[model samples]
Target: MRKVLITGAAGFLGSHLCDRFIKEGFHVIGMDNLITGDIKNIEHLFKLKQFEFYNHDVTKFVHVPGKLDYILHFASPASPIDYLKIPIQTLKVGSLGTHNLLGLAKEKGSRILIASTSEVYGDPLVHPQSEEYYGNVNTIGPRGVYDEAKRFQESITMAYHTYHGLDTRIARIFNTYGPRMRLNDGRVVPAFIGQALRGENLTIFGNGLQTRSFCYIDDQVEGIYKLLFSDYVYPVNIGNPDEITIKEFAEEVVRLTGTDQKVIYKPLPTDDPLQRQPDISKAKEILGWEPKIGRSEGMKLTLDYFKAFSKEELRKSEHRDFV
Candidate 1:
């Protein structure tokens, strides 16, 4: 069986990747520091004969016991709430942690894929961001920690690819939501859903005009998988291009949850992107991929998952980094 090691294997995205790879008959080794990642996201896989886990922080060093065919470095504090609270750790994981993983891939001769985010395009001057667009990022802003770290990550990955000839893939993921997402991750999705569940008004920042394109988790996973296996070594925007404003998206969540609550407005966070939509021409042309799951269908599955959370969890104002 082919062997693959996945970092952040307890995160929403990483755990799903584990399930996908294991289904494809690979011996999947999972690793996470349990900082922002909850083991519950992956506890089900602990008993599988094909699965093994490491509870080490990738920022230090990563050592897998056996030969590996692939490495998916999905281990970072992805959400704003998590990254802002632990900014240094976020920077380290993206910079030092990525460096460590790249070294590991070199030693094992493994193909490595790093998870890059749309935040790298921070408060974009472009409408729909494509791979070639140089981003307009605020290096001194509060949100810069996450954005710059990823930018540095992409830089180093490309350097390794160009200089040392490493087999690398970078997936510039856009906003994605689904099962296993933390209720208080401070993204629009869970915040709206939790408010609807707990009988509170959904809060929108900046007049609810700021837009985002949300890719369903399954579609995001499929696109990442396709990118990993494809020969394309450059970055690919792997997300749904279906864009919606914050106001409309909140309404959808309320409608799906059968809630009567209204939406309340708040001040927008500093450096928050006004618009985020991916131009996935490369994803379509190269990987032959575009998102298949629509928001309505995806929201129902996500709603069911959030509904399963214990009542205690639902009552909390925010659940990030407190687990």
Candidate 2:
């Protein structure tokens, strides 16, 4: 059995990756600091004989014994609320955390995949962002903490691949949604769902005309898996290409929840991207991967997840309101 190390193992995407790898019969080593990630996401995996959990922060040195075949560095503060709340940690995890993981991969002679984001295409100048597009980003803006960190992470990761001839893959993920997402993470989908379920007004920043493409979690994980095992070293865009305006998305959520609540518009946050979509031609050509879930179906699945969270769970953590 191949041994794989996954950082941010307790996170939404990390936990899902763990489940996928374990189901494939890989011996999985899960690592996280529990800073923003909750243990509840991967608690069930602890019972598996092939799964091991490490409560270690990846920004520090990683010391896993034995030969490792693969490493998936998914450790970073992904959500806006998360990065804004812990900006330094976000930067450190993306910078130092990626460095530490690359070093481990070098020592273990393992292939590594780093999770890059569409945020690198910050407030993009292009409509449907392709990997070749040099993004229009404000490095000194409020959201720069996360955007620049990811930019740096990708740079250093590629440098290692070039300088040391280390095998590496970069997946520039777009907006992904499904179960296990924090309700109060300030992402539009979960926030709207939580508000609708609680009979509260759904908040929409700006005119709500800004567009975003939502990829289901399963599709996102599948793309990552393909990129990890494939020999593609260039960055691959992994996300759904179906674009929808925020207003349309809000209406869909209201309709799905059967809620009478209305959307309340708020002033747009600083540096919020006005338009975002991914061009997945590279993923399709290189990895033969494309998102399989439709928006309506994915939203319904996410709403059902939010509905499953108990009222008591919501009361404990404001973030739990969405599930």
Candidate 3:
């Protein structure tokens, strides 16, 4: 059997990736510092012989004993609320943590795929963000902490590939939702579901006019998996291209959850994108991948998953440690 190491193994995305890899029959090594990642997300795999976990931060040092064939570097505080509170840690992980993983990949002769994000576009001047467009970003803005960090992450990864000949892939992941997502993660999808479950009004920022595209978790994992094995060494945008306004998406959530609640509005955060969508032409042409799930189908599945959690479980909590 082949071997793989997954950082951020206990996060929403990381946990799902673990399930996929284990399903593929790889001996999976799961690592996280439990800073932002909850141990509960991955505890189910503890009894499995093919799965072993490490409570270690990738920003410091990463050591995986024996043969390793692949590294999926998904270890970062991804949400807006997350990166804002833990800006320095976010920068460190994207820079230092990524560097550590790249070095480990070189030592192990493993192909590595690091998770990038749509935030790199930084309130994109272009519509339906493609891989080639240089983003419109404010380096000193409040959100720049996450945006520039990912920008730097891409820079160093590409450098390693060019200078050191390390096998590398970068995935520009988009908004993905499904089970195991933190109800309080502050993203629109889960936040709406959590509010609906708790009988609270759905909160929409910025008059709900801004646009975004969301991808289902299964489709996202499939895209990343294909990108990992593909010969395309450049960055690939792996997300659904279906775009919708925040207001429309909120209405869908209210309808799906059968909640008769008023939609509330608030001022949007600084540096938040006015429009966001992925131009997946390269992913389709090169990887033979496009999102197979539609918004209604994906939303229903996600709402059902969130419905499983009790109102008490959906209650808001203070932000804890930074990863």
Candidate 4:
């Protein structure tokens, strides 16, 4: 069987990728530092002989026992709350961690895929961002930590592809929501769901006018998987183009959850993107991939997953001190 090493293997996206790879009959090596990752997301895979787990930080040297067919670097702290709390670590992982992984991929002659984000298009000046658009990013802003980290990740991956002739792929992921998402991760999906479940008003920042296109987890994974196997070397946007205003999304959540809570407004955080919608032309043209799940269908599945959490778990995740 082909072997793959997935960093951040315990994360929401990484764990799902592990499941997908395992289903494809690959020997999977899962690695994570457990800093922001919950081991429960992947504990179910422990029984499989094809799956192995490593509790190690990728910012240091990354080593595998034998040949690796592929490597997916998904180890960085992805959410706003976690990255804001640990900004330096976020930068290091995107820079140092990515460098380490690229070196390992070279040594093993393995194809590597880097998880870039839509945040690289900081408060994008272009509508429905495409692959060729250069983003307007704030290097000194609060959100810059995550944005710059991802931007650097893409740059280095491309460099490795060109310089070392290393096989590499970059997926510029957009707002994705589904099961295994941390309820208190300071992302809109979980925050709104957690509030509605607790009967609290859904909080919206910046007048709820900011728009975001959310892709379901399954669709996002499928896009990434296709991109990994495709021959595209440049960055590809993997997200649903179905855009919705924050206000509209919150209302949708209310209706979906059958909640009576009202919407509350708060000051929009600094450097928060006012609009986010990916132009997935390349994804469709090249990978022949587009989101198969609609919001209503996807949201219901996500709600069902969150609904399974105990009341105490919901209460604990309902509030997080982002500062």
Candidate achieving the largest lDDT: 4
- Name the better of 1 and 2 by lDDT: 1
lDDT of 2 by residue, 111-135 (tens): 9999999999999989899999989
Candidates ranked by lDDT: 4, 1, 2, 3
TM-score, predicted candidate 4 vs. hidden true structure: 0.99
Name the better of 1 and 4 by lDDT: 4
Task: Name the best candidate (by TM-score).
Answer: 4
TM-score of each: 0.97, 0.97, 0.97, 0.99
Writing each residue's lDDT as its tens digit, candidate 4 over 1-323 gives 99999999999999999999999999999999999998999999999999999999999998898889999999999998999999999999999999999999999999999999998989899999998998999999998988999999999999999999999999999999999999999899999999999888888888888999999999999999999999999999999999999999999999999989999787888888999999999999999999999999999999999999899999899764321
Q: Tens digits of per-residue lDDT for model 1 on 1-323? A: 99999999999999999999999999999999999888998899899999999999999978887789999999999988889899999999999999999999999999999999998898899989999988999998989999999999999999999988999999999999999998888888888888889888888887888899999999999999999999999899999999999999988988899989988777888888999999999999999999999999999999999998777888875542211
Candidate 4, backbone clash total? 0
Clashes in predicted model 1: 0
Report the Cα lDDT for candidate 4.
0.94
Error of 3 at 140 (Å): 1.2
Ranking by TM-score: 4, 1, 2, 3
